[model samples]
Target: MDAGPFFHGTKADLKVGDLLIPGFRSNYRPEVVMNHIYFTAVLDGAGLAAEIIPGDGPPRVYEVEPTGEWENDPNVTDKKFPGNPTRSYRSAAPLRIVAERDDWTRLTPEALAEWRTRLARMRDENAEIIN
Candidate 1:
């Protein structure tokens, strides 16, 4: 069963033993894994039993359509595109979910260092330069 807006990026082939979490939001915390399929059994009240696309098959592509509500959100950050806001931002891109094993593993040191450097650069660029 489709879980609606909350399950926007959810896949259809996800099984009962899979893990899920609120990816980009703050209200959702502590990743939850699925433990049951149907509601006939005792519910753990933890993760949801979503139907995500299995990792053994091709990735599913979802076309994103704008709902014309982003402008109403106060947290929306306006970005300058090509020096022209009118002729710049056109449409939203599709959100894709590739099937993969949901295992907990630490990133390699080299990769972590690279990410740290990238983050440092971003922080430097956004830092307030005081006289």
Candidate 2:
């Protein structure tokens, strides 16, 4: 498998209680993040607030430092969802999202199916940073 994006720097320390707030430019919904096959990474200087990608099974959260540099991720185009427009960016040094596994038995069967389908797509797009 592909090693994934390369990012060098100090790693940020995180705790379980830390919250991953969504930026104005971000669509922080768990379902959407997984379905869209978004990637998150851990980088030095990343803020205390992290971004989260929630799958039906579990949620993955990433911590990344804010940088002045920004580039368009070729994997995704500008998304126009009704009144909301979601933009995607790529970093030369992408951070990784680390999350714990938990049982989300409350999800409907349809939702579970969708999550699996999206996860497959995510794998195909290499949207995740595999260490």
Candidate 3:
């Protein structure tokens, strides 16, 4: 799934923010592998909405199109992505890039720093591999 909004189960009506971190994979592999990490958006409905990057600067806002289609096979509930079947409805369009975050990156500084530090450490630890 691309960045922006996406639901966990089959609920599309509930919009949830997401952090699309590039160069990190979910599965076990070389630490230097360049993949993407997906982070769920968390924040209160009141006041200005921030991406909630811990120890970051002030919260920033971004324009979301509310475009996504999440789905799941009724028979499959325990399985996750890669081969899972499910569906989600949205009021916008699908994400063209799984690593779309220029808008989000410009907003939450702390979140961005956290991601950067982690990536640097990974690179430092896995100097033998190229991401």
lDDT over C-alpha atoms for residue 64 of model 2: 32
Please write out the lDDT profile of model 2 over residues 1-131, one tens digit for every residue.
Answer: 11223221112334443432322122222233321122323221111112122323233234333232444444433332332122334543323333322211233567647755776676567563311
Which residue pairs does candidate 1 place in steric collision? 11-51, 11-52, 12-51, 13-52, 14-51, 14-52
Q: Which ten residues in a row have the lowest lDDT in candidate 1?
A: 38-47
Candidate 3, residue 65: CA error in Å? 20
lDDT of 3 by residue, 10-100 (tens): 1112223543234433222343343322223321210112332333454433323333443332222344344432332222133222222
Candidate 1 lDDT by residue in tens digits, 4-31:
1111222334443343322222211112
The lDDT, on a scale of 0 to 1, for candidate 1 is 0.26
- Candidate 2's C-alpha lDDT? 0.32
Off by over 4 Å in 3: 1-107, 127-131
Where does candidate 2 stray beyond 4 Å?
1-58, 62-64, 78-84, 94-109, 121-131
